[model samples]
Target: MIEFTNWDILRNLLLAARWTIALSLTAFIGGTIVGLLLTAMRLSGRRPLQWLVRGYVELFQGTPLLMQLFLVFFGLSLLGFDISAWAAAAFALTFFTSAFLTEIWRGCIDTLPRGQWEASRCLGLNFKQTLSRVILPQAVRVALAPTVGFSVQVVKGTALASIIGFVELTKAGTMLNNATFEPFKIFAMVALIYFALCYPLSLASQRLEKKFNGSR
Candidate 1:
C-alpha cells in the first residue's frame, strides 16, 4: 500500500481535474456548433429536414451517454480506426450536448411572438435575414440561462469518461483510494471538487434567469 500524504492526494486530484475541465469545454464548444446547425435545420420549415433533425436529436437524447461513449470508443475500433479514449469521449459528449442544446434553443425560439416573424417578413426579410436580425436576438436572451445551467450537467457527465480509460477526477479518485485504502477521504474530495466546479455555474444560471425574467 502506498502512503499518500494529504497534500499529495490533493495535488494529484487537482491535476486530474484539469482534464475534466478540458473535456467539458471541448464538449460544450463542439456541441454549440453542432447544435446551431441542427437548430437551423429544424427551423428550416421543410418537412424532410425537420424529420431528419428530429430523428438525430431523438437518437442522441434517447440513449444513455455511457452507451454512446462505448459505441464511439469501441465501435470505431471495430471499423479499423484507432480511436483514443480522449477522442471518443469528446465525440460522444459533443453529440450529447448538441442534442439537448438544440432542443433548448428550439423551445426558446418557439416562445417568440408570431408578430415578430410577420413583421420581419413584411419588411422583405428572407428567412436567414429574419432569423439573424430579429428572431435569434430575442431567442438568445431566453437561451442563455438554460445553456449555462446545462453546462453543469456536462461537467458532471465527464465522470463517465473515466470508465473508458480517460483518466479524469473520478478515475484519479479511484486510483488514490486503491493505493491508500482511503475510499471515504478520496471520494469525498472528488465530490467536493465537482461541487466546487459546478456550484458557481449553477448560481450564474439562476441569476441570469432572474435577471432576464425581471426585464420581461
Candidate 2:
C-alpha cells in the first residue's frame, strides 16, 4: 500500500473538488434555462403544451437521479454514441435540476394573487408583457430563497457522478482511500469539504426567507 501524506491527500481532494463545483454550476445554469422554458410552456394556456411540460417534469422528478446518470452514461454507448463521463453527468444532472426547479418556480408563480393577473390584463398588458413586467419580478423574489436552498441539493447530487466514473470529490475520496487505506479519514474530509461549500448557501437561504417574510 502506498502511504499518502496528509497534505498530499488534501491537495488531491481539493483539486477534485473543483470539478464538483464546476459540474454543480453547469447543471444549475443549464437547468435554470431549461426550467424557465418548461415554466413558460406550462403557463402558455395551451393544454397540449402544458401536458407536455407536466409529463416531462413528472418523468424526471419521479425517477432516481442515480438511474438517470446511469442511463445517460451507458444508454448513449448502446445507441452508438461515445460520450464522456463529464457529459453524461452534466446531462443527467441538468435534467434533474430542471425538473425540481420547474416545480419550485411554478409554486412561486402560483403564489401570486389572482388580482395581479387581472390588473395587468385590465391595463392592456399582453400575456408576455404582464409576465415580464409584473408577475416575474415578484415571483423571482419569492423564488430566490428556495432556489438557493435547492442549490445545496444540486451540489450534493454531484457526488453521484462518481458512480459514472467522474473524478469529482467523492471519486477522489474513493481513490485516495484505496491508496492510503484510510476510508474514515478520506470520507470525513470529503464531508467537511462539502459542508464548507454548502453551509453558506443554506444559511443564505434561511436569511433570505426570513428577510422576505419580514418584508411581507
Candidate 3:
C-alpha cells in the first residue's frame, strides 16, 4: 500500500479539483449558449418552434445525467465516432444544464407584464426587436440571481462524471481511498472541498437576490 500524508492527499485532491471546476465552467458556459437559443425559440410565439424547444427541454430534463453520460460516452462510439469521457461528460452536462436554464429564463420572461410587449409594439418594434430591447433587458435582471444559484447545482453535478471515468474530484478521492484505505478521511476532505466550492456561490446567489430586490 502506498502511504500518503494528509497534506499529500489534500494536494492531490486540490489538483483534481481543477478538473471539476473546469468541467463545471465548460458545462455552464455551453449550457448558457444553448439555453439562450432554446429560450429564444421557446418565446418565438410559433407553435412549432416552441413545441420543438419544449420537447428538447423535456428529453434532457426527464432523463438522468448518468444515463445521458452513458449514451454520449458509449452510444456515440457505437455510431463509430470516437468519444472520450471528458467530451461525453461535458456534452451530457451541457444538455442537462441547458434544459433547466432555459426553463428558468423562460419563467423569468413570462413574469413580465404584458404591457411591456404592447408598449414595444406601439414603438413600432417587431417581435425580435421588442424582445431584444425591452423584454430581455428586464428579464435578465430577475434571471441573474437564479442563474448564479443554478451554478452550484452545476458544480455538484460534475461528480457524476466520475462514473464515466472522468478523473475529477470524486474520482480522485475514490482512487486515493483505494490506495490509502482511508475512505472516511479522504471522502471527508472531498466533501469539504465541495462545500468550499459551493458555499460561496450559494452566498453570492442570496446576496444578488437581496441586492436586486432591495433596489427594486
For model 1, the run of ten residues with the poorest summed lDDT = 207-216
> How many steric clashes does model 1 contain?
0
lDDT by residue (tens digit), candidate 1, 166-193: 9999999998888999899999999999
Q: lDDT of candidate 2?
A: 0.96
TM-score of each: 0.98, 0.98, 0.98
| lDDT, model 3, position 73 | 93
lDDT, residue 142, model 2: 93
Q: Model 3: per-residue lDDT, tens digit, 46-80?
A: 99999999999899888888898899999999999
List, residue by residue over 139-191, the lDDT tens digit for candidate 2.
99899999999999999999999999999999999999988888899999999
lDDT of 1: 0.95
Which of the predicted structures, 2 or 3, would earn the higher lDDT when compared with the native? 2
Sum up the clashes in candidate 3: 0
